[model samples]
Target: MASFKIEGGHKLNGTITPQGAKNEVLQILCAVLLTPEKVIVNNVPDIIDVNKLIFILGELGVKIEKLGSNSYSFQADELKLEYLESENFKKDGSSLRGSIMIVGPLLARFGKGYIPRPGGDKIGRRRLDTHFEGFIRLGAKFRYNKEEHFYGVEADELFGTDMLLDEASVTGTANILMASVLATGTTTIYNAACEPYIQQLCKMLNAMGANITGVGSNLLVINGVDALGGCEHRVLPDMIEIGSWIGVAVMTKSELTIKDVSWDNLGQIPNVFRKLGIQFEKRGDDIYIPEQESYEIQNYIDGSVLTVADAPWPGFTPDLLSIVLVIATQAKGTVLIHQKMFESRLFFVDKLIDMGAKVILCDPHRATVIGHNFQSALKATTMTSPDIRAGISLLIAALSAKGTSTIHNIEQIDRGYENIEARLKSIGAKIERVA
Candidate 1:
């Protein structure tokens, strides 16, 4: 396992560009399997999870060529179907949750898909029932091998049908949409996830000859097509990283500018930070956060404690809640954080509490944070990273703490953020990576 040793209380200045959206790249790369022609993707982040997915595709006989530092061409004209059943596939597919998305495109184009129980963050119980249910709704036969712990879906032909998902699950929606794009008739999806990532996926698919409508709403209508072709796509900037940078700037009293953050798609992220009284200015497409000694939290209209909660698209994302929670430790007031989607994600607050923050874990899903407002700096300590978002959150906390902090299992952070220590170092952060 890798470790990160971070020294606290350094002010950062200058501009940083957020990496390409990780979630979008996963779905987009999976969608490339739907086409037999070359699909050139731009702005693909060079992170471990993404590289793993690319390796999986390469093993499946998808011809890949690197066009630039962050661009690649993928052609799935010849695929190795039997590879999906091999022992190697089981090992690779089980390592990352994004591998599950490949099932959709494979089933849509090849009439069969197989997945060995996918693995991901230990945030909570993330059920795969919605994905299987959507496939079943579209005329696919779903089977589970209890002994091997494997999932398989197959159908000679898929006919489009109406599906109202139990929730607006992001990966679930992408899977269903990919499966339905080439089905025989019209497919209507109600209560769909309309996040910018999903919208971009739909747009890219439309460019490749998939007839999809209702781009930015909960309801999507897709007309089945005979075949899909090649298309070029550029992923949007990572909003989660932008939010994390905002928190870092606030915690370290730094003046930082994040470039081209896809301003319109951020939704409530900026406002959510503003509620904590963070000062940021949006100049054109960039977000500029100025140095501040301390920030105050804003209460509700009735002067009640402010509560920040995660919801579906157009609402504050659950991914940013961890950063918000850590930053709240230094804000001037109290706020409640509700991470409704994942139960155990809020449990990471114990590490922050160990470092001298006043936080109350109400339950698995809720935590109340009372800010220190910089009256006292957090004391450094050793901790283990539980997941990707939490890992970065702890890094932010460590950077603002008083002494030295050592974080183990930094591979979790590397899975999402690209060369995080080098990026932070470019902006004057005192972070060192160790083996």
Candidate 2:
């Protein structure tokens, strides 16, 4: 396993370009199965999950050509759907949650799809009942054997209809969108996930000839097309990475500029961070975070500690709450971090506390952080990463701590952030990867 050894308490000062969205790239790669013509996607992040998805696609006979750094041209002209039953499929498919998305495109074009239980961050029990529910609504029959943990879906002719998702699950929305694009009739999905990733998928599908409306809203209407043609599309910049950089700047009191950031896509993030006394200036498409001596946490109307919570699209992303929590430790006041989406996410706060952070794990879903204001540097220690966001949060904490810190199980960090240590090192972060 890879680990990060960081000599902390050094201010990070340099320019860094945020990588492309990992979530967007995964689904966009699956979108290639919608057509036989060539499709080129640029600004694709070179991360572990994306690489795993590419390996899985290659095993399925999709011709993927690397054009340049962060660019790839893919052609699913002669995809061998039967390869999905191979051991390669079983191993890779069950290794990540994004693997479930292949089912929709496979079923849409090949009339059958096979998937085992998808694996991802162990934050909570993410139910796929909504995904299967959407598929069954489109006239597909599913059979699952719990003993083998395999799921199969097939339909001779898929007919679309109106669907009201029980929850606006991101992967569930992508699954339905891919499947509905090729159905026999129109499909209306209400309470859908309308995150930037989903909107990008919809735009790419539209360019490929699938008629979709409500690009950034929770209601999506899809007019099924007989066939989708090929088209080139570039993914938008990752908003999560932009937010992470913003947190880093505030936490380390460093002046940094993030370029090519989609200001419009960063809905409510700037405002949310403002509540935590972090400010940034916008220069066209870039965000400039100025150096700060100290940051103060804004209180609520009743003069109590403010709480930051997560919600659906157009709301603050839950994935960023961990980073925000780490940043809060450097601010001058107390704040509550409420992670409504994942129960196990707060458990990692113990590691931060062990490093001399003032934190109270209120419960499985909430924590109260009192900033030390660098009164005392966090002592270096050895810790294990728990999940993707948590792993990155620990990395940030370790980077801000004193002396040396060793973080194990770095694969969790690789699952999301692209070349994180390298990127940080480029930005003057003293971190190295050790095997």
TM-score of each: 0.99, 0.98
Clash list (residue pairs), candidate 2: none
Q: Give the top-scoring candidate (lDDT).
A: 1
Task: Report model 2's TM-score to 2 decimal places.
Answer: 0.98
Q: Write the per-residue lDDT of candidate 2 for residues 294-367, one digit (tens) a residue.
A: 88889998998899999998889998999889988888899999999888888888999999899999899999
Rate residue 374 of model 1 by lDDT.
96
* Model 1 clash number: 0
Give residue 20's error in model 1 in angstroms.
0.4
Candidate 1 clashing pairs? none
